[model samples]
Each structure stands twice: as structure tokens, then as C-alpha cells.
Target: MFSSSVHYWLEFYVGAYHALKRGYSNMDVLVALGTNAAYFYSVYIIVKALTSDTFEGQDLFETSSMLVSFILLGKYLEVVAKGKTSDALSKLTELAPETAVLLTLEKDGSVISEVEISTQLLQRNDFIKIVPGEKVPVDGVVIKGQSHVNESMITGEARPIAKKPGDKVIGGTVNDNGFIIVKATHVGSETALSQIVQLVEAAQLARAPVQRLADKISRFFVPTVVVAAFLTWLGWFIPGQLHLYPQQWIPKAMDSFELALQFGISVLVVACPCALGLATPTAVMVATGKGASLGVLIKGGNALEKAHKIKTIIFDKTGTLTKGKPSVVQTKTFSKIPLLELCDLTASAEANSEHPLSKAIVEYTKKLREQYGSPSDHMMDSKDFEVHPGAGVSANVEGKLVLVGNKRLMQEFEAPMSSEVEEYMSEMEDLARTCVLVAIDRVICGALAVSDPLKPEAGRVISHLSSMGITSIMVTGDNWATAKSIAKQVGISTVFAEIDPVGKAEKTQGLAVAMVGDGVNDSPALAAADVGMAIGAGTDVAIEAADIVLMKSSLVDVITAIDLSRKTLAKIRLNYVWALGYNVLGMPIAAGVLFPFTGIRLPPWLAGACMAASSVSVVCSSLLLQLYKKPLHVEDVPIPAGPGDGGSNLV
Candidate 1:
């Protein structure tokens, strides 16, 4: 409320200056100084009447009146500080929808008029239509269509999440593309956004770590001030002894005693303990806000503190450590026939496939034809093409039967293999690649390797983690050769290959891992790991199942989370020092222990000021976190696995 700083400055300080001019002013000083003097007179009268004449009323009354002004100043500062910290809540509320579209009863699914319904009027089961680039109206489940939603405002992740049928949609997320019909499950205060607001409110109501120290000091504060008051009375009273008789010295003695009592109350008035109570939370709130801007969502002080302790990081292969796209890595020849002829046979059989592996096969075949200057539409004998579940296919090529598949397929057909063929397969498999072997008329030929590329940013982020002394591991379902190659490219030393979904969890458990992933199959491992990291990228089932979700799919955000935790912990340490040091050095000054030796006693007013400054220092330090210099760069940071190889041994 003290918005006019100039006006406030001229009034309080000017009044105190004139009052101090009445050299060594007493209760009567206000009476002579007019209204600034009159205010103290009224307070003195009340104290004198209330205390029942046990002690003289002039000084106690004067100081209590000034206490009102000090308390008022404290209240004003506290409100202003609280308002600054709570700005995040107002920003969140601004995301709510102002209007919505309601479905009409026409034969075609038509809209009644565009209804301008306030967010509070929205209810569960309300169907809302969201077009491209609009914040969602309510927390709902998608009933139709698809789109990408930007959830950075809510989850602090920059990645756009893909929302399709059956996906849970949050209110206030921006729709990036396509159209969707959302059936509202929660609206108004029941939404996740509202829940965040409630949590912040509760955090505010909780006791601060510094307040306990203030309470303990305040208990002895009054007694210390009383002693200081007695010293003041003695300094003036002793010199005017009047030959040690009662009647002769009583009048002047009464005057000095009253003045000292007033001084005692003044010290108490100017030294309220409010600032001590606000120190920690203000800093934490500011830190949380700064982290939000940097794409890091720290849920609470506890999580923020624990994050810096991450000693090991385990990465999930698909959609996390890799680019989520598997392609042909290498092609080799074991047969006398041309490579183009083998691909033609393989493509024909895989043309109708929707599987990612099959698509990789088909694409590789097309590329081979283009590279070899052959026609891509080469026809195949469908009669010889056979679909092999969980294996490679068999087809006819140039009037001879050719097989393109795993080594297991050879066993299935009771086909015989020589030592050389097995040796070649062994070398390729060691690289963690998915090898598709070629057999011409039942004779082993060459093999094609399939692999998923490592994400460009994965390497860089992992290296940063390593520099922070956290170990990195890669887990994949690919063969040994392919996994090793990709891991080497990224510079990761630990690799687990050909791991089943269950095996992923078992391995994570064995290593005390923190599993990071973004798929349904990865969910179990994410949950089982010591710290589950779910990478959000529009539709990461793994993120939903994990403990810590990275709303941004970038590996850099993962590193950002780790950095944020460390910095926050640092901030907390500073906070603890501020709290601990203030109390440690503050109590003795308040207790008047030094007055006997040096007479440099700490007045209650000065003690209050020091406590306020310490608190404000903590808050200001936290606010500076907003100016953090590091920008998040997710360039792939390769982490070498040292030679641990890929996948599991269950096969």
C-alpha cells in the first residue's frame, strides 16, 4: 500500500528527525513537540491506566505508541514480498479458457452458437472442440481426432505432445495442429492447474525454518531489554545521589527511571521478528520460477534438494537415447546372386506390412534398387513369399528360392550352415545390429544390419551428466553389434541389448538404475528403476508411468533437471547458513551480555533490523536465480560404455 515511496520517505524520516532534535527527549518531549508528541501522550495514558500504577507510565507509554509504527511498516513490507512471490499463480490462472464450443442437436455434429461460458461454469462430461493453436478448455480425455499440445506453461517442458483418441488432455495446453473433441473430466478448481495453486498456498502457510530461532530469542528478548533499561536508569540516577537520603533525591530519580522504561519499550517496538519468518520460502519460490523458465519443473523443495544427488543415469534406447527410428545399418553379400535381386524378393513380401521392422526392410530394398540403377517396382513371386512371425521372410528370386531372415529361421527350416557363415553372423551380432541373413536355395549368404540412430542431443547431455559425476548406461532391444555401434557413436560405455520389457526392469533393479524412456513397453522399467524418468514427447507412455517426467523430450532437459537440483541445493545451503548464523551471532547481542564489559549493548530495534536484513538477503539471492546464464543446449553428447555390450542374456 505504500506505493508512493517519496511521500512515505518525507513523512516518517522527517518526523523522526525533528523528534530526535529535542535532545534526550522524554515522555514530555512529545507534549512540547506537538502532535508527533501528542501520539505518544495518548499511548502513555493507556499504558499508565492499564498497568495499575505498579511502575511509572511515561516511558512505557511513549515506546508502545512507536511500536505501532514499526509493526505497521513490517506488515506493509511482508505483503509486498508475498505478492512478488505469488505472481506465478496469477500467470497460471491466465491460461484458463474464456469461452467454449458446445455441441448442438443437428443431424450433422454441429455447434450451437459459439458459447461464451466462463471457466467456472464448465463441468465434467462437457464436450469441447479445440482447433489448432488454442489452449484446451478443460482437463479432459480426447474423444476424437489428433493434435500436438504444447504443455510448457503447465509442465515446464517445451516439447509438443501428440494427443490422439484416449489421451488425457490438460486444460490450458495449446493445440498445435489438427482438431480434437475433448470430454471434460475436470473443470474449474478441480483441474490439475488448480491443484498446483492449492499446493503453493499450503506451502505458504507452513512454518519457515528460521521462525523457530526468532521465537526462542524473543522469549528472552523482553528480559534483556529490561536489563538494558535498568542500566540507563542507573547511569543518570547514580550521579544525582543527593547525599543518600530518600526524600531529597526521589523526584529526579523517578524521572530517569521513567525515561529508561520508555527506552525499553521503544527497543521492543522497533524490533519485531517478522523478517526472520519470510527468509527461506521467498528464495525457494523464486528458484522454482526461474527453473520453470529454463524448462525444469521442480515439484517441491524436497525434490529440488534430492535431485543433485543422482549418482547414476540409465537411459532407455527407444525414444530416449535414440531417435526412435530404426533403419538398415549395413548390407553384406553371402550368395553369388546380385544384392538387388535379394532386396526385390524381400520387398515384395514386406509390402503390405505396417510393422516398423518391415518398413525398414522395404525402404532398404527401394534404396538398393535406386543405388544400383535398377527399377524399384520389380515384381516378385507371391506364391513363394511367406510371412515369418518374429523372423525374416522367404521369397522366390530369379526362379531360385532366397531367404532373408534371422539365424533362428535357418534352424526352423532344419537348414544346414557351415562354420564360415556362423562366424560372419557372430561378428555382425557382436555390434548389436539386427542382422537379416540371406540364404540362396538353402545356402547361407550375407546379411543386412538394421539399427536405430542415436539422438543428436543424447551424447552431449550424457557427457554433461558424466562431468557431474553421474554414470550413464544405455539399454536397447537391438542385437549386440547394432547396440555397440550406436553406443560407441554416442560414447556410452554400458549397454544392455535385446532386452525384453520385463528384462529391462530386472536389469534396472540390478544396477540401481534410473530408467529414462517414452513408450508403453518402457513404462514397467521406468517404474521399477530407482528413479523413473519419463520423457514427454506428445505421447510418451513411459513418462506417464515414471516418477519424474520430463515434459520436454530433449535429453538436455534431463541434464537441466539435474543442474537445477544442484543449484537449488546450493541455495538451500545458503539459506541454512543465513538462518543458523543469524541466530548464532544474534542471541548474545540481544541478551545484554556485552554491556558489563564494553557497554555496547544491542538494542531490540537493532536486533530486529539485522534479522530482517538476513531474511531479505536470502530472498534476493534466490531471485537472482532468474538471471542464470546457462542456456539449455541439447546437442548429442556421446557417453562411451567402456565395452559392456548390448541387450540381455535371456535368449
Candidate 2:
């Protein structure tokens, strides 16, 4: 289980030891003596191979040494850089629950007691007693009592959430005081804490893919250097110089060729793409680090690549585009269809529904019932109900045919809408209120306006994108007018309204969409887009589907994300300039370009040493990423509420 660089360095050093043991006499001065012999032999071979055909330079000894040294140096630097970038993920994952308060079954009335157990054994529905200042062992619903829990490790929020019976608690969150019993709902890998660890692991494994232009240029450049080095040796082999060898001209030509070969080998040793190989990942590591500090999660290299191209954005109506706080505005009592009866019908149909819209309707009905006294006596059965997916519902309620849906449901029954009602509906609908048209028997009763507020920073985030020359758009399951109104308010001009999951993906196609959302419904859209950004805190599905997951879950991270991409791209370009510039100067020198005038050719040892310097320079350039601090401007959207909005519940 050694990290890549460890294996790279270990093999290099171990091979160096073996190479010296076989070639040199002294085992005690293994490293230094081997290095000298390798260099001297390389110089002999390079010059000899260059000056004469009767070449006598031993091939393997010097060549193997040079190749290993440069590679080991490159690898050592990489390991250190990766450790720095890995800090955020490592620190977050360390917050896992260490132990749990285990409960064992007893015969008489299930005697309750606690024992310590491994965190892995915690499961859904298992009741665990939590005390103040202890970390909650797993994600669960509180079964008894209440307490405030600090959840900064998972959500990146400093504020603590007050948890009561049925309130969800995440594993690793500290229970700040008060005894409470928690019924585990999600455990182990299903927990939010575990998911964050998994996502980070997956992102690390992904190949930091190369830019096409850079890859092509490097591919040809490496071989060209190889070819040029060969030609430098040929100049020495062509014969006709002041005694290149000792004694005879024939043997002298061979010695001259050997000297040329040494210099040529030095060129090869110096020519490693060590710095070039690191250009992208170094910048990427810094970019992701910048994002992490701002509570933004750039999942991988591809996310860093595609975020610059987004033009149009999409959203889901009930949750993503709205505040997710749908409330009742208007309700009418029909003599035929009573207000209480309508409430009963809608509430019963939505009893098992978890959608935010459905929850709002049910809660609104309960509040009305609590205010206006008991409902009229009417027979109702929980068994005789069915939920319609897109539109509203049709159910047999006390043998009476009741149909409650959107405007389309009224249109299907041919119920005429009055101008006064129509005008009220039209005005509210224009403002992005979801108007549900209700009906009982053959008559249109009245309309209900349930409005979900716009997210606070939605408008500002879109405006920022436009300034960056990136166009912003939204796709949502909301009605056309509702979607249009939200788009207008958010500074988004284009939107695909009334789109389901499949439609969301199709809309994502054509435009280089960066879908930003934080709910399960947005999962498909996240997978479909050129890049998906899951914004919001601790959303499991959003974390999974998106290329980038927002740790803070704010709309402002959208701007930060794009900004990081631009910055990282610039860094990579700078690294390329340096790598290419170094080679441009060094390559010709290795080719005997200065031969006749200077009368001094580079020895193999000196050339290899110079090559190592270039690679080290590249390594130093990559380390500059540590200085890239995330921008200081972080934005937060205040949660909205109005006169009629429900009071915040403890959770």
C-alpha cells in the first residue's frame, strides 16, 4: 500500500545500490562512487560514439543511472505536493464516529441499557442513547427528548441545529447537551459523513486528464530531443579533428565519438518531462483547495475543465429554484365542495408523500383545521387514495367524485373560470405562485396560491456570471409563467419550464450546461450536464451526481467555481511556458550547435546535471500552488420569510 512516489523513489534508490555493487569496487562509498563512474562512463561513450565508428563506450552503466535520478527527483516533489492538497479531505473524513452506545435486548419489557459497540454495527431503527458533547454515532431520527447538535464537520456550518423527536441527526455531529435517544435512519456508508469521504476518494482516483494541445506537443518534443542527441554524436564520428583519442587516429576517432556519446546521454537525462507532467495537477490541486476554503467542492479535474463553458443553467421548481417553503395563500368554500372537505381530500391523498410541495399542502391544511375548529363529519378511508405524479389527483372520497389539480385539471372537467378569480390567479401566477385549481362534483370551486420564495442570492449569482461573459439560464419543473418570473428576478433570461427529469437532461445538451442543484430530483440533470454543481449542504444524491458538490451549498459558489477554473487554467499555461522555454535553450546546446567556435563541448556529467536542474526548476514552479489563497469574498444568502410564512421549527 505504498503511495506512487514512494515506490518510484524506493525502486530508484534500490536499483542505484545494485548498479554500483556490480560496477564499482567499493561497497562502502556506493552512492557517490557509482554516480561518478556512471557519469565518467557516459562521457566516454557519448564522445567516443560521436568521433569514430569503432565505438568503445559501455552503454548501460551511465544511461541507467541518469534516467533513475531524474525520475526519483520528480517523484519526490510530487508526493509532498499531494499531501498538502489532501488536507481538507483527510481532515473531514477523520470526524467519523468511533464508538456507539449499543443497546442489547432483554426478556422482561425490553430492559434498556447501554454498552459500547463499534460504529460499523449501527443500523437503521437501532436506538442509541446520546449524551451531551458526544458525537452522534450515525445518521438517524431522534426518538426521545431534544438537543442542539454542532454539525460543522459535515455541513461546514458553524451554527448548531436544535434536534427534537423525528428530527434527522447526522453521524459525527456533536450533541451539545441534553440526553436524547436516536433511532438510526442511515448508517455506515449511507451516512453523510461517509459519503463525503467516498466522493473525495473517487475524485482523487480520477485521472487528471491532459489538455489535448499540450499532450500532442510533448509527445513529439520528447522524440525530437532524442533524435537531436543522436546527431550530436554523429558530428564527432565524421573524423578530422586535432587528436580526439590517445595514440592512433582510428582509436582516437573512437574516443572522440565516445566523448560525444557522453554529452548526448546527458541531453537524454536532462530531457525528462518531469515538470511538464505536473503542470495540470499542480494547478488543479490549488484550485480545489481554493474552492474548499469557500465551502465549494470542485470534485475532479473534468469539473475544473468544463465549468468555464456553461451558458444556460436549469432548476427544479419545488426546491431548487424556490425557497422550498410552499405556503397556502387563498382558499374558497364552495356550498357544494366545503373548504374543510377540500382540505381533507388533499391532505389524505398526500399523507405518504415526501415532496416539499405535498408537505406544504398537508401542513397548511392542518393549520387551518387547528384554527377553525373540527371538520364536518364525513366518511374517509386512507386505503382509497392514489397520488398522481405530475398533475393532482382523482380519488373516491365518501362515494363522491372529487378532482383537485392545477389549471389543467379544471380544464379537463370543463369548469369555467370566472374573470375575477382568473384575474387574481393570473396576477399571483405572474409573480411565480403555484396556483392549484380545486373542484368537487361538476363545479369549479376556487383557486389556492402557494408561493415559494426565490433564493436570496439567486439574482446576484446570475448577474456575476453575465459579467464573466458566461450566459445564465434555468430549466425547471415549474409552470412556464412561474419559471419565467423566477428567471426574470434571478437575472436569467432563458429558462426551460415544466421539464421533468428526462426533459432536464435534453435541455442540458446543446448548451454547455452547468446544472446547479441540491436535491434528489436534480440527480439526472446533474449527470446529464457538461458539468454538474451540487450546491447546498449535505444532500446525498446531489453529492453523488454532480461533478462538483457545494460544501456550503450557496449560489455564490457558482461564481467562485468558474473563477477557480480561469485561475487554474492560467497557472497551467505559465508552467507550460517555463517547461518549453527551458527546452528551447537547452536542446540546441546538447546538439553541438556551439561546436566550432567555443571549442568546448558539454561533458556527459555536466549535461545530466543541467537536465536535473531543469526538472527541479519545474518542480519548484509547481510548488507555487501552495501560495494560491482562495479569494476572500464569500457570499451568504439569508433565509427568507414573510407575514404569512410558517414559524421555523426546531430540528
Candidate 3:
């Protein structure tokens, strides 16, 4: 009994005294002193009973017991609630498999055998075989065979990606089709999945700006309450000692000493700083987890808090709004061949080229064959292929010399160019499209107009942002003509074109700007903006510098991020109002402020229950944010009446 009281209970008393010595106070000190007062006073009553064979008033051993028990219960519930806020992160960590099947090559290296080994034992350059319906154990490139891998969990992309020889596969992704041999390139912590998990853990531990406010308020809250409790005791006890108290003002069951002690203890027991401390962090925790589930990763509380107030969102033109890769948007042919035939001839000639534009033309032709029909059942292979570096490519296709490239390639080959072809190429260049002219037997046959097309959702998302009264601006390092043409198509009116990376950052200074980009050049601007959002498909430099990452790589998630932030901030404000209001009204009532009127007074045990209830109420309110659902469309957001009328009704 002595150890329990001296060791366990004494810690609270010591902490309370320590806080007092520091010229501040805390909830622990108030709780410890409040319960100890009731217990020590009761001990005096017990000694009086033993000496005089008569006890006066009540002995409150039960009051102290209930106070400790209720507060302990509240603490346990708070821990449990905080655990639930991180469930999404737990689910992500569970995606990786523990073991992998190592592939051992037989003599002559023709046949291979499988040996099951722990994932930790795998290393770079080691070969592994993944069967259909199994997870890829580590990041690797396919060395043999072909299959489809589901990378939805890692990238938030729903469709399965076709994995062929030389294609890279991420660890933890599921193989959905044929078996494949993979040579490991990255292992263990070096994989993308591991990095994402670490980022989320760090983000959850970070504090927001509002949490600092709550901390400042709590530093003064406990000290003020302790003084209030002392004043309440003095006010009643002094008047009663002078025999000036009215009968109706005092409780029926007690005299001045009993009444004073009851009111003073109640005042200390009912005051709660735990509720105020939990208001912001708990809401941020749940909101971050909710964002991960929607493919939007919020790096920390500062990003979440700032994202809610973003007035202007600046988007980088090239990779953020567009597909970030050249595609065959328009194709025209002058010869007797059809459009699809011209594409097939161009694709066959450009298939062996390593240039991005050439690869785009080849890919477009492959898609055309799948959708419609191939012009030739078997594509003729090109011979004596030569790349002219910025000019184009030339090869002998089926004994006929075929050259596919820009006008420079056509001019060097001395290919015949008609007035009609010149007009066609000029029209494409004016629209910011790269022209890939196809020539067979030194005759200009056709041209493929390649360009980076805007993402299907970009225009709609920009229009939606405009409707929300939030200004959307386009910032890019590209030429003004190209930037203006892309901006007009995407519904953006403000364009900051021909600006360098450093200039992009300077343009956003002193504004609540959200810079969205996906390139190495965008890193400086991303770091300078109030909130940096990077596309998942972006370079490593951009992603590392960003505050938020969009795993879906869709412009719609920008809207989702902003909307989620507003909703999360709303929950935080709601929590603060509840906690502050509860303390403001309950503290005075517990101090017997109503005793002189209706003769109402809170007992010590009742005050303890109210304190526990207040903390639980704040936590429960934060948990309601888990019910948040993203809006389906812009129309789902309620429109305001005027321009300056407080932001959108997103909540």
C-alpha cells in the first residue's frame, strides 16, 4: 500500500510541483493536487473519529478512486483512437511479401530452377522468377518471357501494365499473367514501396501550425485554473467565518469548511487541457490517412493546413497538365496510301530509332493496328538504318529506300515536296506539333503531326477551379506561343510563359501558391511555393522537393487535395470550438458560481466525470472526419453568391 501511493501516485504530485517550479502548470499537476486534497482531508476525518469515537461530515476515499479511474480510462481511449487514424498506413506496409523465388541457371544457362529465399537475402543482379498470381518480390527488369503486372497498390493505377523483356517492374506488384524471369535491380529499402512507407510515417509524426496555437494556450490554462480554484475557496470561506452567509446560499448537507473544500476540488478536477491539446493533431492524422487512400499523399500537417488556404494554384505546363510525352495527334498523307497505311510505313521505318518522337510514332501505329486493322500482315524489316541526330531516320524498307523524319531529312534526301505538303506541315508547326514526314522512293508521301496532348481531365479540372473562385495560373519555361496555345485549350487565362526555373519561383513570392510540376527544372519552383505538389510520374528531383505527391498522376487530384484540406480544417475548427466552449462554461459552474442562486454545486466525483467526457467528446469529433468522401464533380460543390463571399462551400 505504501509503495502504490508513494511510487505510483507520488509521480503525479511531483510532476505537478515540477510544473509549478517552472513558473507554469499542467493538467497532471491539477489532477494530482485535486485528488490528493480530498484524500488527505479525509485522513484527518479518520484520525478524529479514532480519537473522539465520532466522525464529522464525509470521508471521500471513493472520490479520489473515481477520479483516477475515469482519467485513466480517458487516456486509454485516446490511445486507441490515435491508433485507428493510422490504419491506412498499416495496410500499405502489409503489401510486400516476405520471400521470393530465386532463379538458378542450369549448366549452359539454358534451363532455370526455382529456390525459395527470404526477400532480405535477395540482392541486386540476382535473378528471380515470378509466377502468375504472385507478388513481384523486388524491383527488377524482365529478362525473359512476358506478362501483365498489377501495380495499382503502389501507383494507384487500376489497369494492369504489360511487362515484357527489358521492362522494369516494381516490388510488391502482383503478376497477373504468364511467368517471367526478372533480374533484380533494386532490393529491400531501395525499392519505391519502402520509400513511400517511410515518407508516410514521417508525415504522421509532424505537427501543424494550429497545434502550436493550442500548445501556447495550454501553457497558461492550468495556472489560471489553479488560481481560480483558490479564489473560489477564499470567497466562500472568508464570508462564512464572519457569519455572513445566508442559509439558502449554502448546501443543505455541509457547513463552510465542507462547502469550500467541495467547490475548490471540483474547480480543479473539472478543468481539462487534454481536450485542447488533442484538437488539431488527431484531425490531421485522420486526414493524412484519408488522403493516402485517395492517391493523394500529404507530406505533413503544414502542407495540409496551407493547402486549405491556397488562393492561386500555379501549374507547370509541360508534364503537369499534358501527357508529358509526344503522341501522333494528327496525320496526313498525299500519296494513294490511306492514313493508316502511312502510319504503318512511318512506324516500320521509325521502329528501330531511339528518339522519343520516333517511339511515339511507332506506338501510335501499333494502337491503330489493334483498333482497326494492320495494312500489312507482316511488317517489312528496315536495312542499313541510320539516324541523322535531330534530322530524322533513313532505311531501305522492302528494297525501297524509306526516309521518315523532319523537313530537313526530306530536303537532304532530295524528296519531292508539293505545295499541298508544305501547307500541311506549316499548319501543324503553327499548332506546336512536331511534323514527321514520310518519304518512300525519294517521294514525300505523308507526315505525322506529333504533340503532347493535354490530359483528358485537365480542362474540366481547370474549369472546376474557376467555378470555386480560386484563381488558376499556368507557369512554364516554354515559349509564349506554345504556352498560350496550351493554356487556351485548358481554360487558363493567366499564363507566365518564357520564364526560367528561378523566375517561376519569383513569380509566386508572397502568395499562397500551390506550384504543380513534374520535372527536374520544377524543383526550385516547387520548393518556393506555399505548397509543392508533384505528379507521381515526375522526376526524382521534383518528387523529393514536393510537399504532396499525386500517385494517380491526374490533375483531378489537385482538386481532391484542396477539397480534402478544407474539410480537414473544418473538423479541426469544430474540435477547437467544442473544447474551448466546454472549458469556458464548465469551469465556472464547478466553482459554485450558481450556488448563491439555485443552490447548485458539483461534487468532486461528478466533476471528474465531466472532465473525462470533455476529452472523449473532442476525440470523437475528430474521428468523424473518417467519414469524409471526395466530391464526385465540380457541381457537387455548393456555389457562393458573390466573389468575396468566403471561399467555396466545400464542406
Among all candidates shown, the one with the greatest lDDT: 3
**What stretches of model 3 exceed 4 Å from their correct place?**
1-22, 51-55, 104-111, 140-170, 181-185, 247-254, 329-355, 361-426, 429-432, 436-448, 633-651
Error of 3 at 481 (Å): 3.1
Model 1 — which ten-residue stretch has the worst lDDT? 642-651
Q: What is the TM-score of each candidate against the true structure?
A: 0.62, 0.78, 0.81
For model 2, the local distance difference test gives: 0.64
Please provide, for model 2 over 209-276, each residue's C-alpha lDDT reduced to its tens digit, 9 standing for 90 to 100: 55555656655655565566566566555543555433342233345655566556555545545566
**How many backbone clashes are present in model 1?**
40
For model 3, the local distance difference test gives 0.80
> lDDT per residue, candidate 1, 281-326, as tens digits?
6555665556554544445554444456678777777668765666
Q: What is the lDDT of candidate 1?
A: 0.61
Q: Rate the local accuracy (lDDT) of all candidates.
A: 0.61, 0.64, 0.80
Write the residue-wise lDDT of candidate 3 on 1-651 in tens digits: 767645656667787789789887777788887898899978876787788754456777888888877777677667766688556666666777889989787656555677899998999999998899999988889989999999888766678999999888988899998899899987888777776777666777899997988878878888788888899888778888777878566655456877888888888888857678778888888788778877788899999999999999999877788777777777788889787767766777777887767877888888888778554344667788889955789988777788998777888989978999989876764575666789988998888777776676787888888877789998876545567767777778999876878888887786688999998878898999999999977887999999999876888889989999999899888988887877788888998888778778889999888888877887898888778876654334334232111100000
